[model samples]
Target: MEVGFLGLGIMGKAMSMNLLKNGFKVTVWNRTLSKCNELVAHGASIGKTPAEVINKCKVTIAMLSDPAAALSVVLDKDGVLEQICGGKGYIDMSTVDPETSCKINEAITSKGGQFLEAPVSGSKQPAETGQLVILAAGDKALYEAAIPAFDILGKKSFFLGQVGNGAKMKLVVNMIMGSMMNAFSEGLTLADRSGLNPRDLLDVLDLGAIANPMFKGKGPAMLQNNYSPAFPLKHQQKDMRLALALGDENSVPMPVAAASNEAFKKARSMGLGDMDFSAVFETLKVLKHSS
Candidate 1:
């Protein structure tokens, strides 16, 4: 099937590259046209707008920054819904709340287009390597129909029932991730203040049951004070807040997630939003020194 990809940010570019590398016919569009240049050279077609993409492809995938951007592209004046028709498929890989996903699904289904939420679990490197885990939700037939494309973009894909479940799953996963990162930041700061080497602390953690791929992956970067944006702090904060909101709506108290949200809020308040989430370490460091 011909696929159109929208949004060419860090993860989006990597995912689009994977699709191209796997020999899928992909047409791409980005708000910043320059972001599509490299993909264009790699034999991916570039489109000027979402309408043009939907016009040319059977499946259109979006990996935008947030719900607002996703809504803008899918519901805008010349957006996807404007051009989508029966037999066309729209899969959103952006991390958004379930409510937003449901709204988008409604718009697409009303227009006779199939909709799926297939938010991913992984960062840029995983996306580039096709190691992303896709959490998909939509009509069963539609999920099956998109498997070929999903296989090219990810290592594994799960069909989790109807639209919105994928987004809900993403929020839950990110809530734990946000909390873990904050806890690790505090631990690292405590170790350093006790005159214990950060590297040694990382090594110890790696050997313990508390160790996870997140710490193993981010620990070195944190130790070296490299805050490059594998996942931006602001986005992580957004996900945590969304997760907290979900908890509130369901009447399920997520005290740890709530606390993590506050940490990310503080991090953003300190102008660390654009940095890698591991920059939460810097927040902990500042607090430690002040104390």
Candidate 2:
């Protein structure tokens, strides 16, 4: 099946490369034309716009940054809306609010287009390695049709059954992820301040039931102050903010998520916004010295 990919930022680039490597015909479009260079060189077709991508493929997946960008690519001139119609499938893998997903779903289905909100649960490595966990919802038929593509892109894919479910599921998962990162940051800094090697602490965590790939993977680099943008800190803050809004809308108490959101905001204020989300560890170091 011909696949169209919109957006070529960190996640999008990694993902489209995986699809191309797997022998899929992929047509890609990015806001910045230069961002498509690597993929274009790797035997992927280059699309001038979202509409062009949709026109060239039966299934088009977009990994946009946030709600506004998500909305823009679909609603703007030369957008997905222009080409979406019967027999076409649109999958959005962006982490956004449930309401936003619903809005997109409505727009696509109104024109007889199949829509699926398929947000992911992993960062750069997982995306590149095709190990992401996909939370998909919307049309079941579309989900079934996209399974071949999803299998190549993610380690697991869950069909959550409805337009908003996938979006809600993604937020809940990311909320916990953000909260855990905050706890991890605190533990790392506390260990350092107490004259214990944080690396040793990482070993201890790894030996316990709390062991997770995130800590094991991000730990060493974080200790070396390598805050590369696998997943930008600003985007993490955006997810935290959206997750908190989801909590408020549902009357669910989310104190931990709220606190984590503030920590992310503080990290952004420290000019770590463009760095990896792990840069929140930097914010922890700043707080340690400030106090």
Candidate 3:
């Protein structure tokens, strides 16, 4: 099937490449034109605008950076909504807030276009390997119709019943992930200050029931103090804020998540937002010194 893919950032680029490798005829666009050059080399067509992509393909998948960028491409003048027609499908794979996704859904469906929120759970590596888990929400018929495209992009796709649920699920997952990462940082720092080798502590943790992919993957980087961005701190902070808002709406107390959100905020204030979320370690270091 032919597909239009937009927003060729680190994760988005890997995802679009997977679609092309799976032999789908792919048309791609990015705000920065250079991001699409590699895909163009792999026989993917490049579009100059979101309208161009929607007009050219049956399905348009967006993996933009944030809710603002997603809305800019879909609701701006000559945006996807303007170009979408009946029977066309739009799948947004960005990690946006539920309210934003619902607004986009309303706009798409009102224009006679099918819409699905399919926010993903893995980062660039998983997207590169086509092993990302997709949390999808919208019409079941459209979910089934887009299954092939979903399969090409990810190992599994879950139909979560309505437009906003997928975005909600993403916020929930990221909230837990952010908190876990912060806890790991605190433990590692404590081990170091107590004269235990941090590496050994990581190895022991890896063997324990508390072990997780985040700990295993990010531990080595923490050991070496490398904070390159797989997932940026600002984005993690954004997700945490959204999750806390979700909790507030439901009258649920999320003390752990609230604390984690402050940790991320402190990290951002330290100018670590452009770095990996692991840079939360730096904030923990300052807190440790203060205490």
Instruction: Write the residue-wise lDDT of candidate 3 on 1-291 in tens digits.
Output: 899999988788998999899889999999888889999999999999999999999999999888899899999976898899898999999999999999999999999999999999998778899899999999677788889988977888899998899999999999999999889899998998999999998899899998878888989988888998888899999999999999999999999999999999999999999899999999878877899
TM-score of 2: 0.98
Write down the lDDT of every candidate, Cα atoms only. 0.91, 0.93, 0.91
lDDT for 9 in candidate 1 is 90
Give the clash count for each candidate.
0, 0, 0
Model 2 CA lDDT for position 118: 98
Candidate 1 on 29-140: residue-level lDDT in tens?
Answer: 9999999999999999998999999999988899999999999999998799889989898999999999999999999999999999999999878998999999999977
Candidate 1 global CA lDDT score: 0.91
Lowest lDDT 10-residue stretch of candidate 3: 138-147
Those runs of model 3 whose alpha carbons end farther than 4 Å from true positions after fitting are 288-291
lDDT digits (tens) for residues 94-200 of candidate 2? 99999999999999999899999999999998999999999999999999999999999999999989899999998888889889999999999989999999999
Candidate 2 achieves a global lDDT of 0.93
| Candidate 3 colliding pairs, count | 0
Off-target runs (Cα >4 Å) in candidate 1 are: none
